[model samples]
Target: MQEFAFELALCAHLERPDRVVGRQLGAAVHGRRVADVCLVEPGPEFDRRAAVTPHTIPPLAIESDAGPGTARPVAEAFDCHPDRARAVAERAVELGFFEREREGASTAVRQTVRYPEQWFDSLVGIENKPDLDRPGDLRDQLRIDASLGLFDEVVLATETYVTGAHLNRLPDAVGVWRFDPETGEREVVREPEPLATDGPGIELLDREPGRAEVRPVTAAEKRRQRRRIAERAYGKGWRTYELPDCERCAPSDAEPADLADARLPWCAWTDGLVRPVADCGPTCPGYEPVDGGDSDGDAEGVPPSEGPEAVRARRSAWEPDPAGVDRRQAGLDRFL
Candidate 1:
């Protein structure tokens, strides 16, 4: 089953490769499930809180074979069967993750609430932005539980799966956006760091109580860490798939690669802008994805692709984009 594919790819999908935009990847396990991972430049970052709230539960709530505390605890609250452990554990993780994120958001909101009226008056930036006072190298101690892709990495269970984006209006502010499956809309969330801490280092220093300055993570550092985690996860061989739609490559086009290119828009793939997946859908034309590179299955039992060559056309091979499209779109569309 590609059951373990998405779980493993969770990390990599979050931290896509470097300068590897405008590419789509589908990978799988045992030819069952897969994950559809795209790298693209999206629109401005909106208030995720303002966006539609995700109805689909996250994976962090499940009970694991490991223990009670973890997302996947050993046996359920009851002594459930071990065979059913994985499924149960996985579900728990998803839900627990949603809750954990909610709790963190709540905490951040509380901290923000404590800001005095005068503080808010002069607040060009968050004076003491959503601060997290963990007692260790938080960046190093991310809880990467039930590791499917890579090991020894920090795991973040935000309410939404990120699309790795930037806020156009606020060029300096980077956004990690996602199309929340539950809400059926886009949402953007904050990464580890943004504002500088009022104190020095991980160690705390005396500062205004309510006016504390939570240190935000650096953009470069944030990108680097995310890339590392994603690389480690993609290193695994589970399957991966996409929800559908790539705005640029045109999923509705008569071609396959353009539809799935990460550099494109989500609609290009899912919205029928490009040709549909030949093998899976109805009215089957029945052609294989010649360029369907490195596939890894997700919960939906699809696979991922590999490398830029998947979308490129060769003299002897059929170009994934059948309209005799621009070769530059295959690579340069990422700027969009």
Candidate 2:
């Protein structure tokens, strides 16, 4: 597939990505699904990446080395369509810069969302989603953002309370956007919000004809999708995913194996919580566990091996909460 200029900018914003949520408000300037807007945690890294190589640069850089103080200049030098380039600038003003990280092997979209929102402020691109233009049964855009491999579900609502005030604009629309698990298409329905209130930006009194169509999930469908979503918790939760590895896929210029012969699951590379322990080589600072134990359970007991059963284990090797290992403010500035 061809790459979007936003690809790099997106990478910059989602370097060590965790979760992403996008909502569609209007037509995307690029004639693509406008997620309307997206947000990345640790939003600073994304900013640095985009600043280094803003996609708006003309004559786009060809993997060349950047000269000194050249970050801003690159963005100014792109030779492309004025409207297209202008769209980048406009988005910068409307949606603040993103924070991404250096690229790694394997992956296209770190992750994708319900719809890439259209930030152009013009309704010209506001046609129904390709998968959502149906009259009305049920429809939802169920996609797994491939970024950090943590966020997995986006519940599509015809109009929802998205970050930038979605559902604020829209009238005479008659149908709810839903996902049909069996057929996997957006559906339209004639019901309003399940609760007694009008959701977020929707006004209760303005129940005009065809104004409030909602395709709520049936109890059975809800259960099935819910289970499906739950099983896919990694892209949506703290669980990690297994990375495929094979002979050619493995490193070619790799170092010989250690006598210990222990390797953490590749998923540990991005798993937020128990990550430190995964890199537990003698040379790594995270090499030693907080308490030198097998489980983060208690202060006493020779627990089972965390990674190696033959190796001795102790209760002292774990942090009180395994999740605290990657904490941003544990104040281990100079020391772990």
Candidate 3:
């Protein structure tokens, strides 16, 4: 099976029980590679409460000769004003929520933001390798993950048959799993050893072969890094698959629970989850036409094209809302 298929099945399985799954995430920590699949547990009740309530203090506005901007109270661009916004900004500065910057003429400003930190309980990283025989840098990458100790747990999810030799090469702390993409079956070969997130960590450096250097990370730094990583994961979930704009394949017709897990909309007509792309459309055997009003028809004046490049161009027009809902009705047509 292809790695994409394996990753998709894994994502479907992970989405169960309300775990958030993100794929191909840009590494939040510097010097780390992009994670193949990242699973983050929901944050605590405190974090959820904080997310719903806005900051009591309003952001400070910075008016300049060029234009208007907002700055943290500590920023050089931050000129004190006797307003409520200033009071809140000033308090935030005192609380160490803002990092100050002073530029030559225009003071560069930065905002130290806080996320729903309590909402994220743990981060689990998975490396998908469909063919272990063609392993390239797999061992090194897992080792780096182990040494860096960024994720609470790291595991290798592969379709390849596990052997004693393969296990011997990988770090004992890292977990191993046998995955079957077709059946969505997963078997755990080794349970991962939980890494210490509350304490200081060691950042690994690929300085020399067999002689990796390490840097000490303070607990405060780790906390900040964890938040950054979790925020990215929240924005980029594993539901990267796009829905085909077919009249017969209206998302509302699909089972919401099944779609949430599979990332593929279920077609009751087909009695299964149809491919999000090519397998959908009027020409398909299971296609059942609906009102063209909701379909991406030529009523919008844009002709459809089937080439890969054209498909990519079309996909770019759609964007996922923060809540992961597909708001197809957004953009130019809304104006009409």
lDDT of every predicted structure (CA atoms) = 0.24, 0.24, 0.57
Best by TM-score: 3
Please list the Cα RMSD from the true structure of every candidate, rounded to 1 decimal place.
Answer: 22.6, 22.0, 12.4
lDDT of 3 at 250: 39
- Candidate 1 deviation (Cα RMSD): 22.6
Q: Predicted candidate 3: what Cα RMSD to the true structure?
A: 12.4
Measured against the true structure, the TM-scores of the candidates, in listed sequence, are: 0.21, 0.19, 0.59
**Higher-lDDT candidate of 1 and 3:** 3
Global local distance difference test of model 1: 0.24
lDDT of 1 by residue, 43-109 (tens): 2221121121212211121111232122222333324565554454444343232111122222100
Q: Which predicted model would earn the best lDDT?
A: 3
In candidate 1, residue 289 scores what lDDT? 38
Comparing 2 and 3 by lDDT, which wins? Answer: 3
Candidate 1, TM-score vs. the true structure? 0.21
Per-residue alpha-carbon lDDT of model 3 for 1-336, expressed as tens digits?
A: 556656766676666445556688654344666789988776564344233222221223212111112332233344554354445445544433443344455333333433233767789988889899999889878876776677899999999999999999999999999987556678999999997778877666455766866677777767766665655565456656665665544333433342222334445566555666656777787676664454322212234223222322233211122122121223523432
Residue runs of model 3 more than 4 Å from their true location after superposition: 46-71, 74-116, 207-214, 244-261, 265-336
Candidate 3 yields a Cα-based lDDT of 0.57
* Residues 1-336, model 2: lDDT tens digits: 001212211212222233322223211111122332233232223323222221222111211122222122223333556455444433332222221112243111101111111211111111232232332322211111111011221223332212222332222132234322212234443232222111122112212456843233233432232222222221122112221221111111111221112222222232211223333345443333234333222112323233322111111111111211111223423432
Clashes of each: 98, 56, 4
